[model samples]
Target: MKWYFVLACYLLAPAIAFCNSYGMGLTNLNLAPTYGKIALFVFSSLVGSDGGVIAGLAACGIIMSIVCSAADLMQDFKSSYLTLSSPRSLFVFQMICVAIGCIIAPLALWLFWTAFDIGDPDGEYKAPFAVIFREMAIIGIEGFAALPKHCLEICCVFFLAALIVSLLKDATPSHVSSFIPIPMAMAVPFYIGAYFGVDMFMGTLILFAWQKMNRREADGYAVAAASGLICGDRVWSIPAAVLSILRVDPPICMNFRPTSASV
Candidate 1:
């Protein structure tokens, strides 16, 4: 919450980025939640429990942002490596994007909050991640024993299964191991819901069709198309948020609900 804490986070960004480049990003991600909890515990001890939750949430955001930015930078570096492009240029571009995002993301959130009731359970945007984060923060503050029994059991099962699969994947031949389902990808739907999985499935099917049609052009076309789609999806969010601010409700927004009153 203090200015010094904020400055420390910025100063640590380059170190985080370096670690990620060397494949230590996963280690950082694994440790981040624990570190956040420790940071929150310290903040609570210093400031009392009254405003500690807000400070804790800010700490979580800062940690998550650093880890995510580093992971993204590593991805960009991989893309640049494959393309024989300049990593410095990519890093500069990413920094510019991060600066813009830091300004724009909060504005979009504020606009949406103003335009619609955000925290309502029945709202169009359920803010599922926010709910998850809040629950995690509570767990951090209280302790793991506070988590539901069934949730703990399920977590244990998945953790064991993931460990086994990771060992198996490493031991197996590369050609055979390529078929193994990514543990993270398999687990994503549990946290983010099935919509993202559905989108990924659809994209895979499209890519398959493209490869079948023309394997030669598929690589180039697929990369270009995927990049365009990713950019378009994010770019559209800005205008959509602007429209929300302008109170422009389109017919497409209404289509989310059923038209039949009988239902």
Candidate 2:
């Protein structure tokens, strides 16, 4: 079973490489879904629904773990390179951290699971990315029928647009091309939700203002500031989860969303 998966991954290496390369992926995690979708499509064609769905899901899970770890370790490796730290020592620490995570993660997940309805349609903690991935798997099984009307055509249009954008970027100078949005960047919000777009817009707006005011400080502190904001946001979730488990609900919680539509 393990070797079958290994062989599957080995077979799909070219697709992975192509996606990573042509998609302009800066990190592994974001590109995992693309490869997963590819795997799902290929396997569904090669084998029947029963085997293929399981294989596709298994591949997706493996890919997720692989990419997540790769992205995490790559950041650490780059930081180590900058600081002149021992790679062996860093690897040892990473292994230790992984061991700790293996023990701690389940407990943390249990706490959250108790606190919130994770995948509920009307729940506060809807797992949108999971929904998207599940939809991809369903589409793999049901073919074009699972998708919204003209969804495939829309995707084709975007695909051509992306290709054209890529070519124009190559043809144009750096200054001109920098203004153009990459397809992958655009796809992030599409895969996740509109929230990411809003988040990015705010970040970009702040950075733009900062740059106009003080380019040097903006350039120096932009990444650090963004990192701090992101870290704080995630860290706050722990306390929020704890409060939820304690049966304390925030009085002022509000939700503003569009009418329910499967996008």
Candidate 3:
């Protein structure tokens, strides 16, 4: 049975490598469902794993695959930081923070859904938040709804917060580690904030234009300009999204801090 499992993983290695090269984490995870089906078939063919035994093994493998994938993601982050010559001490601290951040993700999600009721009305779900609920439902099976809501809220909130801060502040893992609690405080969806950020930036451009024309407005106009900027920024997403699709790989480094001493 053990050898069979090893063989299965070996066969799947090529597929996994291809997915990784494409930077498709979701596609990689999706393969586990197929692997689960294949494992059951193998178990039945080789050792006569009956319904109960087969089901149990399949469940275990699926869980193990998710765990391994998440670990790989962490290692990827660690490698990226090292590639940029981040301090060893800072990297270790950030890893610890990342662990804490992972725990917080689900809890954050539960809270958001509880507060905003943000799910598909027909049960189809979306993203960082959906993952928490979907995994819980799968693992808990019969008792999924009975799971603690706070746990759901934390995880969803934490991951998004990390992504948003990474996007907006250009924070390094070290900076993220130091201000780990901020994401939990305001659980905005990362994409939503990003949209707003674009609008704000555009408004700023308009304001600068007006200022150059000697048409400076009152303080109230400043606030209005800010709002307009946020609205305009969403237009920028079209180009960014297109670029992301063209670029198969996500950028390895983000939120870099430069040395002013170079000046």
- What clash count goes with each model? 0, 0, 30
| lDDT for residue 178 in candidate 2, whole number 0-100 | 92
lDDT of 2: 0.71
Tens-digit lDDT track of model 2 for 34-110: 66676665555444466656666666766655555545666677678657899899989999998898889889999
TM-score of 3: 0.25
Candidate 1 segments exceeding 4 Å error? 1-62, 88-139, 231-263
- For model 1 the local lDDT of residue 162 reads 87
Cα displacement (Å) at residue 191, model 2: 1.6
- How do the residues 35-91 of candidate 1 rate in per-residue lDDT, one tens digit apiece? 454555444444344565566677667766776677777777777877999999999
TM-score of candidate 2 on Cα atoms, chains taken together: 0.62
Backbone clashes in model 1, listed as residue pairs: none
Cα deviation at 177, candidate 1, in Å, is 1.6
The candidate, 2 or 3, that scores higher on lDDT is 2
lDDT of 1 at 131: 80
Using Cα atoms with residue i matched to residue i, what is each candidate's TM-score against the true structure?
0.53, 0.62, 0.25
Residue pairs in clash, model 2: none
Q: What are the lDDT figures for the candidates, one per model?
A: 0.68, 0.71, 0.50
